[model samples]
Target: MTFEDTWKPKIDAYRAKLDEEVGPYKALVEGIDYSSENFNAVEALDTLLTEKDREITNSTAKQLVAKQRDGTLTAVEIYNAFAKRGAIAHIFTNCAMELFFQEGLERAKELDKYREDHNGELVGPFHGLPISLKELMKYGGKVTTAGFVCYLDNYISNSPREESVSIQILRKLGAVFYMRTAQPQSVMHLDTDNAITGRTSNPFNRKISPGGSSGGESAAVAMGSSVFGIGSDIGGSIRVPAAFCGLYGIRPTTKRVSGLGSLSGGAGQESIFSSQGPLTRTIDDLEYYMVNYINMGKPWEYDPNTIPLEWKTGVSLPETVTYGILLTDTLVEPSDAIKRGLAYVQDKLRDYKGKKVDVKVITIDHDLMKEAFKQTLQIYGTSKPVHDKLFAISNEPLLPLTKFFLGFANPEENDILTNNNIKEQFKYYMYYLFKDQGIDFLISPTNPNVGEVPKNLTHWNYSSMFNLIDFPNIIFRTGLTFDPKVDVKGPTNVTDYNANDYVNAPINLQLTALRFEDEKLVEGVKLLDKALELA
Candidate 1:
């Protein structure tokens, strides 16, 4: 059989399954115009849901768990609310790869029964919380395509090869997974558009990207479809989506969260490994997920690569903390919206100086950043042959972003050695930079621009630099949105890259701390998030 002949049936079967899962919620999404170029799904459809439904769906994960534990809400009610809203989000943005609402409802019923039997005691920290997963993560007896069409028919065995380590941990903590979100083909693009599920658009502005690899999760959470969701990032996958969609997300240092059994494009490439973390609307939820997943999940016991590190809570920062501000990467200047957001934070910090925090501008080595970006491309390019073989299985035409990534030739051994040397040298450079400067953390734009139009995305210097250096980073919304009149383009002599006018797009700032200092990073982010009133 030809590749098309072999893959057509598999693709059709998956679509049929998705239809079947969403069939029950057809009435909920009825009368919704899915083809509108620009519309706010949250404002339009939120009123369609009952106040109770809205309350449960919009509550943070911690709040939901508290309600469930206190007998004020049931897991089944929470699951049904999110499931219906998630179905609507799928219709609007094509963000869901798989929906198992029936399965989720059944699990919720079990949890409610357990809570009743145990005298209103909760099962775990995440009890009764509706959490979504990126399609790349393994779900027992389910298929994980990771946006690769060839893997549509590949399913995990029900018995022994069931869940990924991260899923297993979340399951044990009483989290309910009703949906698997969409991602881009090859799972390497900054935007989430794939042959199987199409593209996931921003909830705020459908014409622009939701941010990828984790775009679907961001969109779903932003629209209150799920309280929070899991997103894996090697190069700003989680943070970019969260920033674009006006949410909160973190990319922890590698191996802090177990990746065992999770499907990835560069599975064995250790040059820059991906780390999984939560993407939520609230910073507290981000903290809750990280703390519980590490301390309660005991990830090191599940994945050998994970370090045996305890999750430290209540980490006290110094009364006077220092922050280094990075205005530009020198490769590309941030848009007006991003510049305004940075200035807003700088002014806030300056006002708070001597009372709480200290702020200063720190100059970065543009040459070193350029080298790091090149090295990142080389590391990512190593997976080209693997991706080629996967696509060849079904003879699927490469997606635009996939083709763009593969254009970079793989580096030779000597080049790889040289890149490694550069990485090590840059790592120490940052280490001493922080120490000599007495900077607790560094702040910069999550992306050069707020958000981009689909298929026009490029420039990962703002985020990829940290990925190359293996530092933990968090993206927090600055409570600012793009305005055409306010964010007009300035004169530029540079010709290589041109900034796009992102309308109504959210602006976010990224905060980075030293390697393996994930806890400190989270604490620092909470402080900044509060100071900025970004709750």
Candidate 2:
């Protein structure tokens, strides 16, 4: 059969399966208007819930777990609330690739039974917490699409069902997974879109991107669909979306979280490896997932690439902290909104300096960032062959973003030697730069601009440089947005992509620490988060 003929049935079957899965929840959404242009997922879901249900769905994973353990809320109630809300989020944003609310509800019931049988004992750290999975993570018996139409029929495992190590950890911790979020076709773009699931719009403003390939996760969490969700990043997949969606996300140093059993078009090309981390509305939830995933999950035992490091809790920063402010990376100057957000934080830090926190700012040249951005593209180019093969199988036309990425490196070049040399040299430069400055962490714009309109995202240097150097980075919302009246175009244009008014788009900043300093990065972010009143 022709590839198109073979792929057509698979696509139809996948849609049919989604229809069947969502069938049980149809009645729950009967009163809701899915087609309303005025529909806001967060507002609609909040209105749908009782005051008590709203409180349960809006609580952080840590808060939910505590309530469940104390018998204040049942597992079934928590799961149902999130599941129904998740359905609403999907309706508004097209964020879900798969929905298994019935299965998730059953799992919640089992957890409740365990709690009752054991005198209100909990299953694990994440007991009764409703979490969403990125499309890349493998869930047993579920189709692992990875946003590729070619893999629509590819069930997670053929024999004894297997889940990704991260998913297994979450399941053991009593995380009920009702939905798998969407991603871009190649899982490489900054916005989520694919042949199977279409485009996932920003929940904040439908015109802009939610940020991908983890866009779905950010949108869902931002819309209160899930308390927390897993998102993977090679470039700015996790951080950009988190920033754009007014949420918190971390891109830990590579391999900190297990990638085993996860699907990626860039699989096996480790010039720059992807890392998995949590996307949440609050900073504490980000820490909650990291601490438990490291200490309780024991990732190293399952994934060979994971480093065997215990998660350090109670991380305390010094009384005085130094922050290196990077206004621009040289490749692209940030938009006025982002610049204003940076200045706002800097002003706040200066005000609080020497009293409760010691704050210092060091501005560094962006020559290294320019080189790192170029080299990171070369590293990403190594995965073209893998992507080419996948696309060839389904005879699918390449998306614009895919075409742009594939043109980054010469296919004939031996990427291993060249990319590694570039990485090493960049690392050396950063080591001395941080040493000379004696800064705790470097802060910059997470993206050159706020969230982009779909298909217009091009410059990734702001976040990709850290990926090139393998530093631990986090993106936190600045609690600011673009004011069209105030933020107008400056005389010098810094970006080549089309610029928009960016009305109501969230502005966020990136913070980074040295490699293997993931714990310090989180602690530093918390301090800055407080100073900026980000919570």
| lDDT winner | 1
Give per-residue lDDT, candidate 2, residue 435. 83
lDDT of 1 by residue, 244-296 (tens): 99888999988889878878778878877898999988888888899998999
Top candidate, metric TM-score: 1
lDDT, candidates in the order shown:
0.83, 0.81
The alpha-carbon lDDT assigned to residue 319 of candidate 2 equals: 63
Model 2 is weakest, by summed lDDT over 10 consecutive residues, at 490-499
